[model samples]
Target chain A: SQQGEEDPQALSIQEGENATMNCSYKTSINNLQWYRQNSGRGLVHLILIRSNEREKHSGRLRVTLDTSKKSSSLLITASRAADTASYFCAKAGAGSYQLTFGKGTKLSVIP
Target chain B: GAGVSQSPSNKVTEKGKDVELRCDPISGHTALYWYRQSLGQGLEFLIYFQGNSAPDKSGLPSDRFSAERTGGSVSTLTIQRTQQEDSAVYLCASSAWLPSTDTQYFGPGTRLTVL
Candidate 1:
């Protein structure tokens, strides 16, 4: 069963615009990680935010976690056409190695 | 270094037949996982293996779904008596099992179509 739920099933923005996506989960998590998938390929790890972390930035990507609200958000700055793909938020259970992933947010960057 | 790899990037089989999907994780990684993704859907966790310990099969959906990792390097997922609902992309991933959160490297995935 999936532990996370992403909002705004799809989002479209012009190049250079910033895009934000949100995810909410049901149970306590050891950590939350984001991944990107292009077309039909496998997913690539993007960023990870531990339960203790509130915010993290990696290059153009910024992520914020709110353990109190049981939610997280991913922000992409100066988005480009290359950023068009599906983004997923996965939750790692506090005491287990299993990762339950959300349905994902499909982001389309119009050139 | 080579990333994780899976065999038969695409597989088409008839219902009631059996299919085996393979995954070769990055060298020296101690953790591997299997997930199933239906069309335009989130991945469903199927199973997990960590080091030499017993695998965690709690996520498996049915008795027909089974997996095995040989020598802690290569793993295979087998679906017996395939059903049409079994059609989906089977993805494999591996992690280094670090002290904290570990990032998983994935394979291209095998697209299984049950006719």
Candidate 2:
């Protein structure tokens, strides 16, 4: 079974708008990572937020983790058409090296 | 450094035939993983290899699926008696360490279509 579930199965937005996706998990985790996948390709690692951290930033990507709530959110500011892709959240469970992934949210950024 | 790489970007095979998917992890990466992604679906964890330890095969869907990592670098996933339901993108990723404080780099993946 999957340990994480992402909300908003799909999102559509115009370029230059901000897009946010949320994910919730069922178990305690050491870290939560986000990835982006283009059509017919493998995933690319975007960012990772540790359980002790509340927020992190990398270029246009911002991620927040609320361990108390077992949830995390990814914010992509000033989206571009190139940003159109499926986003997934993977949680590294406590004491486990393997990551469990969520169903993912598909984001389409129209230019 | 070179990233993770998988062989045979696309494959089309008949049902009941066997197939072998290969993955070559980044040099010095100790953790390798296999995942399956169906159309319009998220990735499903298949197996994980950490260093020289036993692999975590808990996520394999059935007995037909099996994998082996040789020398802690290259891995292969073999499916016996392929089925149409098994058609999907098989992805491979590798991390430098366990617990993944470091990012896991992914390969282009192999698209398998079991006809």
Candidate 3:
């Protein structure tokens, strides 16, 4: 069973725009990680934020987690066509080693 | 320096035939995992392996599905009497540390099509 759910099944935007996707999980977690997948390819780890932390940034990507709400958001600043891909949020459950993933948000950045 | 790798990027087999998928984790990685992604769906965890400990097979769907890790590095997933519902992208990933802090590195998934 999926432990998390992402909003906006699909998003389309122009180049140089900003893209924001949100995810909400069902159970307590030790950390949350975001991943990107290109067509027919493996996933690429984007970033991870521990439960103790609220926000994290990696290059142009910004992620914010609200444990109180059991939700997280991924923000891509100044997006480009190359940034178009499926974004997924994976939650590592507390005291568990497995990561439960959410239905991803497909982002399409149009040139 | 090589990343996680899976063999036979694509596979097509008849229903009821068995198939074996292989994965080689990054050197020194201690944790390995298998997941399946169907069309337009989220990834479903199939199994997990950590070091020399007993594998966590709780996620496997049925008794026909089984996996084994040899030498604590390479792993194989075998499905006996594959069904059409088993056709999906089988992905392999490995992490150097525990899930609490480790990040999983994925390999190019194997797309299996059962006819």
Best of the candidates, lDDT: 3
lDDT (Cα, tens digit) per residue for candidate 3, span A59-108: 99999999999999999999999999999999997667788898899999
Assess the local accuracy of residue A77 in candidate 3 as a C-alpha lDDT between 0 and 100: 96
Each prediction's TM-score against the native? 0.96, 0.97, 0.98
TM-score of 1: 0.96
Q: How do the residues A36-104 of candidate 2 rate in per-residue lDDT, one tens digit apiece?
A: 999958889999899999999999999999998899999999999999999999999766778788889
iRMSD in angstroms, per model: 2.2, 1.5, 1.1
Q: Candidate 2 overall Cα lDDT vs. reference?
A: 0.92
Task: Report per-candidate DockQ.
Answer: 0.61, 0.71, 0.78
- Candidate 1 lDDT over residue span B1-115, tens digit each: 8999999899999999999999999999999999999989999889999999999898888999999999998999999999999999999999999314788888999999999
C-alpha positional error of residue A19 in candidate 3 after TM-score superposition, expressed in Å = 0.2
Interface RMSD value for candidate 2, one decimal?
A: 1.5
- The models' CA-based lDDT, in order, is 0.92, 0.92, 0.93
Q: For candidate 2, lDDT tens digit of each residue in B5-99? A: 99989999999999999999999999999999998887888999999899999989999999999888999999999999999999999988875
Output the TM-score of candidate 2.
0.97
Task: Give the least accurate 10-residue stretch of model 2 chain B, judged by summed lDDT.
Answer: B96-105
Which pairs of residues clash in candidate 3, taking residues 3 or more apart in a chain or in different chains? none
Better of 1 and 3 by DockQ: 3
User: How good is the docking of model 2, by CAPRI class?
Assistant: medium
